[model samples]
Target: MGKLRVKVDLALCQGHAVCMQEAPEVFRVNETDGHYPKVEVILEFPPEDLREKVMDAVRYCPNRTISVEEIPD
Candidate 1:
């Protein structure tokens, strides 16, 4: 699997949990504060199926806080 860097814009994020609901493994919203402490989860690329799920998360983010950048080695 290829590597992808995901970054979240906290300033733009409105504490919405849509990203979290879409990709809990990659993005999570704090239940106490309803905010994202750190949304970006830059681990090794997940499996193909999960990649699709992550893509959905990025695409569906209400605040458009998530971004996926593919890195070429």
Candidate 2:
């Protein structure tokens, strides 16, 4: 199995939770910490094609804070 990863630039996040909204299994916000705080998350790399989904999240992000990188299988 391979590992899929998502990177976020907190500086540009702008508290947007689109990634979390689109893929809850892969993204989250830690409300306990503060408004729109990223909590422990995972990138659903199988089934629905996570790379594309994460990319969409990155592209749709008004702040452009999300990115998806593929790992060797």
Candidate 3:
């Protein structure tokens, strides 16, 4: 498998934190005082070993904001 590139659409994100729940190592939800929580990509290019969890994060995102692309090494 190739390296994985993960991205999140901030505009559409609703601070659900599902991605963080699914893949804590790759995704994080930042909660601010006034603003809505936002997702942070801790690992933009996670290793192949994390493909399954990363895909789970992508699949389970309620807003479908998370995206993953496979990059050839």
lDDT per residue (tens digit) for residues 1-73 in model 3: 6788998889988899999999999999999789889999999999888889999989999999999888987
- After superposition, the stretches of candidate 3 with alpha carbons farther than 4 Å from their true spots are none
**Model 2 C-alpha lDDT per residue in residues 1-73, reported as the tens digit of each score:** 3566677777666556777776676777666455455534554353446656666676777777776566766
Candidate 1 lDDT over 1-73, as tens digits, reads 4567677777777666777777777666654455455454544354456677688888887778777777675
Root-mean-square deviation of candidate 1: 3.1
The per-model lDDT (C-alpha) reads 0.68, 0.64, 0.91
TM-score for each predicted model, relative to the true structure = 0.70, 0.63, 0.93
Clashing pairs in 3: none
* Candidate number of the best TM-score: 3
Can you rank all candidates by lDDT, best first?
3, 1, 2
Superposed by TM-score, candidate 1 places the C-alpha of residue 39 at a distance from the truth, in angstroms, of 4.2
Q: Which prediction has more favorable TM-score, 1 or 3?
A: 3
TM for candidate 3 is 0.93
